[model samples]
Target: MTDPELTELRELAAQGDRDAVDQLVELAGERGDFDELRSLAAAGSSDAVDVLVELAGERGDVAELRRLADAGNQDAAELLAELTDED
Candidate 1:
């Protein structure tokens, strides 16, 4: 994608445009737009997951974290452990 397209995508996401989010994800997945996908995940966009799996850096609620961990999110599991330990 060109810089202009990326700028437009970023603006759309910033505005909470769901169609833009879905379109971006589809474009990234189909066109190897990995960097944009990674950016969205890093920004805490829930659109990253097909069904709510935890992204590497997301600090989600404990129960959800545990669920994701059980579904194979190592980082989520680690965060859950750490969060639980502090309780």
Candidate 2:
């Protein structure tokens, strides 16, 4: 997205637009933008958390999974356990 469009979307998201939040999560996931996803998740987007967990799992990023798990994401915790079992 262009800078202006991204900024507008972020503004809408900050204003509690659920659709905007979902769009941002989709964009972040498509770009593999972990920081963006993390920020969205921190702002209470469960969709963002789900995407982050999926991304971490796909990349086999145990540390990221652990961080998400520690942050109280149940899906992340479950995935982390599954990954640990694979070791």
Name the candidate that leads on lDDT. 2
lDDT of each: 0.64, 0.95
| lDDT accuracy of residue 20 in candidate 2 | 93
Candidate 2 segments exceeding 4 Å error:
none
Q: On residues 24-57, what C-alpha lDDT tens digit does candidate 1 reach at each position?
A: 7776656545466656655665565432433332
Clashing pairs in 1: none
For residues 1-87, what per-residue lDDT tens digits would candidate 2 score against the true structure?
899999999999999999999999999999999999999999999899999999999998999999999988898899999999999
RMSD of 2: 1.0
Q: Which pairs of residues collide in model 2?
A: none
Q: Please give each candidate's TM-score.
A: 0.46, 0.92
lDDT of 2: 0.95
Q: What is the lDDT of residue 77 in candidate 1?
A: 76
Q: How many residue pairs clash in all the candidates, one count each?
A: 0, 0
What is the TM-score of candidate 1? 0.46
